[model samples]
Target: MSKLDSLLAIPVLDRSNQPRIQAAVDGKAKPPRALGRIEELAVQLAVIQKKSLPSVRQPQLLVFAGDHGLTRSGVAAFPSGVTVSMVDTLLAGRASANAFARVVGARVSVIDAGVAADLSDRRGLIHAKIAMGTQDASKAPAMSTDQVISGLLAGADIATQAIGDGADLICLGEMGIGNSSSAALVIHRLAPAPLEICVGPGAGHSPEGLAHKHMVLAKAAARTDAAEPLEVLTQFGGYEIAMMAGALLASAKAGVAVVVDGVICSAAALIALRLAPQALDYCIFAHASVEPGHRVIMEALEAKPLLDLDMRVGEGTGTLLAIPLLQAACALLSDVADLKDVLEAAS
Candidate 1:
């Protein structure tokens, strides 16, 4: 069997709490605002005032990088060192995300959430480490509840500050090895889907490696207590994921648009929706990733992803790609000559 097939073969345990399930299922809960043709026309009208008017402020990209203890168990196809290496590549402007962000005219900020390696002297990186790394989910809890809350708060604070610094739109992304396992655990808790549907071949794992990952995740899920969102996050979630969730909430509260990337970011978005369903008003699903479970999460949230380029690289590449589309949307709404205006001129 392929890696995805083997992972899907494992039975999913019911680890969701009643309150969360009820809240997620409750239709009376504030229904998400679906932007249809009329809403799209309205958004266009609001922004397209005049060509001479200043365009909306430049978008900002926030990339959160951390290390997952699950990597130590060979659950991932890439080594743990890749996490630090990718951060360096990002700093050096050599990563694919950097190139993509530059093309979209978005400024990228890299936050060191909790990479195991020291990045103390990195000049441009944001130092927001909550711990050396998250705890191994296979043997014990991923992090303390307090730690998870702190990480989330810190991430939100960063996004708030970025907006204050003149950012109008926000794109959420992450970098971490073995994070897919953490994402799977979070999705399982938040959505109550089959384990196979929640899990995917992160970074290209072989069949045996993927099966091993599924078994470890199944064991972790079995041991977790699903009483509350925070408790479940502490039990089996990654620090970066929790922080991204917090950032999403903060962006909504701040009234800024948030573009969500692939599966990992979608996990965070799911948590954000659970914590504050109103936050959905400020979100835009950027893309559908090659990861099998990403589409499932997107559907659950009723999110219509903007792009589907088979992108599985995390670091906000998909979100960055969507920035130009958003710019075009705003431009078309505000700049195009209306039929009335054209008729008046002709007359």
Candidate 2:
């Protein structure tokens, strides 16, 4: 079996410890459910790990960078070159994600899933490129079958590496300029919702540009075979997106928490959820993007995101910002004394 198949073949999520984890959280010195969503992240982490007090200790941010051919079709305001430039900006640790990662004590790694530019010379970039970029979905398939497998394996390998290297949790991020358009189309198919609901202004489109994007993406969505995961990938998904889907599966298979970002990542998460429904057991939605499609996809996952800041910067910044919440969740249960323990100690 292929790596992707092998991973998915693993048993569904082992939520056998659900009651114990919830009890542990309630038993903390804090009142029942006092930590709110922090407690929620914690409880879910415990269930995924099959243990109470699961640590968010070695959090790693996996940022998959790519370019979209749809951008050339005037679907977005920023030129595709910005994808390469932003990947470099991210590698320099100056991007907003880096700042947020610094605060959460998480390591950030960028994967070149398929940037149109050659970043081979850039130090510290993961060379997982499937091609220079995908074919323009408006004109042809977004990716080939082989590219699909390659992208999925590349992402699976990254998540496996993070787990092998002791990463307790991994967050998904991306840097493809026109990928918001690609993401919208994926959401349209996977959400199986109305195509118009998924369309959104990418990079602040002008009225004319927004209308053009809608026209292009609506056509793109029509081309998709939404019922099958791989078919929808070829029809609408980008390399970064395909890779993130793989990452979600690998993380879930290994029983690691996957912190998912906004709409683009949500698009990938939607695909991953389709491929492996139990992946949601390992996923924590980081935020709700301003992108309209995000609402539909997030609803599909039945996910309550950690934040709803009107943030749409998509470098996994939302996931990075939400990392501390995971940390706080762990601390709340692990570090805080149990009510009975405190009471007994005071006697």
Candidate 3:
């Protein structure tokens, strides 16, 4: 097996970790009541007849923006300027995510995890910059451990506060040039797969550029110890990815459902799962991305993505689009009429 495979071979927890799951589920559990089999069937019948469950009271979208040093190595098709521009677009309510958030009634919040350009601390922006930019990973470590830890802590704190602000559902998105490379590194470290299986043409890279990206990432991995996954993230992952991972952890801890977008967000989810396997119970895979490696990661997580719009955008667009489906799932469980209700209507 390859070194990447061996790293992923490390066994984490399995289904036996019900205590953690119970902590999340029982956090809001009520006392059990006695019921006859007929009554049990009646409750199930009622659920089928209703076809909709209790509405999710509050949903929040957390967008993390950063800059990747690997962009300096020409790994990404888009320049770092796009990160700042997109942040402005998001703030102006003109981005695709903004439009989708409006459709779902989700509150949006943006965080400057490490954008290279300066953003004014205005309304709707969370000032959580860890560094102006990560170090050039093509040459050395992308970020120091202190910066990564700080970013993670900031993200966790923000998520906890959002939960306290009455957010029951959390959607994760990211903005960072060359972030796909950082995601690939994290995926490589956490997944039982080859680097090539986890690398893809991010932001429309040409074949040659994609090859260069894979080579640089492989060399970087060779220089690092895969045994320490968080160390790999600190050294090679994007600040936004690190922060998003922490947000996933916090959401799990807070008993909120987390919706994960495409590949980059999936990478963050993988890292979070690595840290706390129970976190997976709270995550819903949003969509299948066009990126080549995304499927492999999804398979490793055993996640069935809700949609396959061929989207590769990292600004939480996929997650935003998938919100309605979640609503529909709840609706099906609570609102749809069952056979008994139909027979009664016929009578």
Candidate 4:
């Protein structure tokens, strides 16, 4: 069987430790449920790991970079070349994601899922390009079924490698210029929301530019009638997003925590969750994006993110910011003493 097929065989996370995790969290020295979302996060990590005390010591943040064909239609405020430059910045460890990784003590890696430029010479970047770039969805299907499968398989392999190298937690991020438009379309179809609701100003767009983007996205959406998750992804075409989806599947299968970043990453999560409804058990929605469509997708997934930072910078920046909370959760569960134990000591 193909790698993608093997990843799909992942069973739903076993919840046998549900009571033990909840009991452990409640036994913390704090009052009942006083820790709020952190407690919930701790329980989630525990359940995913099948242990009452979980650890987030080793985190791998994979920033999948690609180019969108929709950019050629003036959907983005920046040029598509910016995607290439950003990939180079990531490789040089000069991007904001790199800085954030340093601060959070997480390892950062960039993958050339499908950039329009030739980045083969980049020293540290992972080479897994599915193509130069996807076709313009406004004119044709963004990718073929085979391309979508290949991208997903490539992503799964990258994620598996990270896990094998000691990544207990994986965060998803993406850098693709026109991908916001692609993400919007993916949300529109997969979330079953209105096209207008899914379109937003990505990477900063003027009012007129945003309007033109809506028009272009509408044209692309009308080009295909694919409502299924994978079909929608294939119709919209985004190598980075597809790879992110693959990574999500692989991480969940390996019983690791997956920190989902902003709208684009969440769009990829939607595809993965649709394929394997159980993968949601391993997902941790890092933060709520300022992008309007994000709420729609979140609501569709019935996921409540850990933070509402009103941030829209994708490149896994939000994920990096949220990693500390996961660490704190782990500490709260593992390091803190039980309330009864503290009381006995006091007596």
Query: What tens-digit string does per-residue lDDT give for candidate 1 at 1-347?
Result: 83212211322222233333222222121233232432342242232221222244578989999999888777889988899999999999888889998888899999999998899999899999999898888888889877987877888888889988988788998999999988888888787577788899988988898999898888887886573667777887887898888788776666567889999999888887776665675678888998877977887788788788999999999999887777765554445554455567889
After superposition, which runs of candidate 4 have C-alpha atoms over 4 Å from their true positions?
A: none
**What TM-score would you give candidate 4 relative to the actual structure?**
0.98
Task: Provide the lowest-lDDT 10-residue window in model 4.
Answer: 2-11
Q: Mark the regions of model 1 whose C-alpha exceeds 4 Å error after superposition.
A: 1-55, 345-347
Candidate 3 local lDDT, 176-239, one digit each (tens): 8889888887887787578888889888878888888888888777877754657878778888
For residues 114-201, could you state the per-residue lDDT of candidate 4 as single tens digits? Answer: 9999988899989999999999999998999999999998999999999999999999999999998999999999988999999889
Every model's TM-score: 0.85, 0.96, 0.83, 0.98
Point to the candidate with the largest lDDT: 4
lDDT score of residue 92 within candidate 2: 94
Task: Compose the digit string of candidate 2's lDDT tens values, residues 230-307.
Answer: 888987789999999999888888888899998999999899889888778788999989989899997877788889
Which candidate, 3 or 4, would have the higher lDDT against the true structure?
Answer: 4
List the candidate 3 regions with Cα displacement exceeding 4 Å: 1-52
Candidate 2: worst-modelled 10 consecutive residues by lDDT = 218-227
Query: In model 1, what is the error at residue 310, expressed in angstroms?
Result: 0.8
